[model samples]
Target: MSIRKNVLFACLTIIGLLPLSFANAAPDDVFIFSGTRLPTALSEVGSSVSTITAEQIKQKGYRTALDVVEEFAGVTVNQNGGFGGVGSVRIRGALSEQTLVLIDGVPVNDPSSPGGGFDFARIDTSNIAKIEVLKGNQSTLWGSDAIGGVVSITTKIATSPKAIKAYVEAGSFSTYKGGSEISLSNDLGSFRGAFSGMTTNGISKAESGDGNAERDGFDSKTFSGNGLIYLPASAKITAAILYNDSMLEYDGWGAQTGVSDADVTSETEELSGHITLSLPLFKGRLENTFLTGYSETERNYFTSGSKTYDYFGDRLLFRYQGTLNANETNRIAFGAEHEKTTSGRDENSIDSLFILYEIKPMKNATISAAVRVDDHSVFGSETTSRFSAVYRPHNDWKIHGSWAEGFKAPTIFQLSYYFPYSSKVSGNQDLNPETSKSFDVGVERAFLKSRGIIGVTYFRQNTKNQIDYIDGWYENVNKVKSKGIEVAGEYRLSDALGFEVDYSYIDAKKGDGNRQLSVPKNSGSARLIFAPSKVLSAAITMRHNGLEKNTYGNVKSWNRLDINGSYKLSSKLELYGTIENIFDEEYQQVYGYGTPGTSANVGLRLSM
Candidate 1:
């Protein structure tokens, strides 16, 4: 017998020997075509996936991207200021720079930033249609920044012919926001354009009138647009552009012994375009996509500091899907990408190619393998590979496992920046990328009758030649390990009520025999939702973060509650309100920084 046939028989035999818990009634309906590609149900993916739909965002009453991440599962944001504060995302207890953020499938990691982390203050979640978070090491599917995971933000696709929507909200600290979106569609294609502006007089951080810091806040604005062209057959092309300009004033770093005044202003622009073509080839559906993008960042500091950086890149992808036989299926994808970053200090670039294959030898069984090779301008060439599997004896239960290898390239800021601090501080222009391997296992189940889902997953990651920043120095550390467990679930009590709970625990230490610092070891969220009527909806959520103790002898912890509600007056208009920090909690994710308290926001949304 052929190898394909042998594999199919073996997979079917294994599925037949599983427990009855694997048998379950399917969902009432499928929400997205992409969800089926994952190993878990839409709700049970909490261990590795956190999804928030556009409707959820509207009902939650959030403003910035930072707000969303703060409430997301397995996510923690260290806020440095109020709404405009610098923020970082940590997944599986990884560093901020290890995570990757994507807007419509384009990377947003700043090439010139001090940490290569995307500035969350520049993102307004109001315009996002859907957000899908793939946690764990996804480097097998995505490249580079996938060492920790990937967060993909998809914009709203226009289907209506013509519409105009706008919203305005105001709250504490003289905060206010206003924006409008217009969509137009016809026989040839569709177009969507939006402009939003926000400003805040900002409140002082000190309590009881000890406010010495002035202009130590954030103010910013953004404009974005997108266009889609549909062909007669099954082909489409899309383009997107966004620009953000802002000014920030903050207390200087304690590097100089006393608080110094700092005023920083900068501008950034990002542009992306892609074309997709689908057709039948080799008895299967073939899809090809070509993408190109560019980003430019300019910074000006009042303390005689100025920098300009730009990056240009392109990528090509080819994917094929088909059925191998009566009870077998397969998918194959391959791609290549290249990027060049230009700054006054140096010109750096990377070229990479990868291929992946997924096969279902039998019903409810899937196996995938992938490999990638990258050529870096400074680090020569390296290769990585991954293997994973999912076994489903029935529709409701799945067993998943994976082993993967990934690496991260050093950003321009990490290589060239120099500062005045300890004499041991230094930046290595010849620094090599950090490399690591990860293993993960999980089980997921969905109970359709109760509309409930649950999942448990454990992950371990080991790294060698890790890069880190300490006391103004960038150094290469060796042998770091991290292990964690996540348990999450959701239940639908009735047509009008729902409940969700998520928790994560992690343990990590550096090879130098010190604990990784500034990361919470335990975190959780509990949410309750109510829809008393078709036109009205309400929700309440509580967040808890366990104190994290660092080797430097520092500990931090926080808890907060939020409530939101919305009422629809008609088919085209709705009113919403939210109260954050209902008890006026005094807390900060980062030491010495205070968060906004007891703030309230109300707004009206109009569609069509």
Candidate 2:
């Protein structure tokens, strides 16, 4: 037998022998750090929430956060080519940019955009500790862009006194990556930091021999680092920086249809930092945090003039939580946020304040609400709100429901950018913020006495006054609606074998008859994992994207398979490998874009 096959069999044998021991272990405690009014237990969240842990990321061999998120129902990613292209993610048919992203309880979405949507592709998962996704409108607590849902990424915070880890790998497409991390922690103080870089030249296509747009390739580079410090009195501080440069030198749909281009480049630089403090208060806990950051993005389409913009923002929050007591459970938080943008012909700003409150009426029931108001440079003022409820009837089952609203202020470019698009156009300074209302209801069931979890959710959203460019002019569309059903589950088949599945069906429509670009009707993912021994693990994943019909009368669909494995050479050394698009599917989720094909990479990791 081949060495690889022999290893797989050996691991399976070990797992098969530990079934009883695996089931007899102590029950685990689940925590939900990004849902509800505060960092609460998973059982306390009043709405549907999902978590992807660091171990899961490694076990699944996911190269990007977007890839891992696919396993969750109602989630889909719009990716292009090998490097940087406009990439986004959608949840329940909602636009990609509409979902809010947070880092350590602070918003990271670029307020400079009309939708305040940030591209998910710009983030690397190397430094991420965990991700918590809260599906449904979160506008009440997070304000704008939370109309669709929320994705919160929390970086690693070291607890050990000292540690160091490093890895290097080479993969398909002539891609190479390497990184190192160091962390120091003690009773008096704690500090952690990480640095990573990656590069890629080109990719091998499934259908070769032609200069097809899909054959166009790319080159990419990225550097990122983050640091955290903690004080003795429960005070913490953090700083982080990220930089990415990508060049595309190929043709896709844009090339096939006469808009042929050979060079497209995207560059981005961002730096962010924050400080937080928590203290005991009058019969409750008082906490505060302040965050600030800056980011710049420039994209050159070869034909389109290079567009550049810079953004700056800050946020401050304060909260008070009373201890849990019979018939008395309450927690409240308030915060203020502001952002400013600067660029040629594009200058804008916003200021807002928001608050959230959670109350427990009974032992098994809880209610929560949030509200926010924002003043925009152009749109003037807007308000958002939400309310939710949670009920637990059995130790293994819970039900949650919520209703929320959100608003998005127009961007400087969306309002003013003008080109010789058959005519001269002017900015619409009177454009109003896009308004959205959404709701969700779901049930979470844990089987095998809590060894497995299954969840189903139904969600709907209606957005009005959507901004669009029409014949060199900007206009507001009347209405847009998105509704969907999602089913997801995670099961531990054995101590060393596990599986997760997610499926979603979305029905999205525009009141004006224009189709929403890059939104798919059906999407799903399945993952199977095997941990043969403490030192060896492997995963197989499958992804499905349903056919989408564009407004221009074009249809497309895609499916891809991936495999990942890792082995521990010793207590401080490890080896890992990932093979993406194992079947080499050739397809596009976007109308005119190149997608990565089959690729593979192997690397070694060391820790001390």
- Each prediction's TM-score versus the true structure: 0.85, 0.85
Report lDDT (Cα) of residue 53, candidate 2.
84
lDDT of each: 0.67, 0.67
lDDT of 2 at 415: 69
lDDT at 444 for candidate 2? 90
Clashes of each: 0, 2
Total clashes, candidate 2?
2
> Tens-digit lDDT track for model 2 on 547-588?
776544353777889888999999999999988888878776
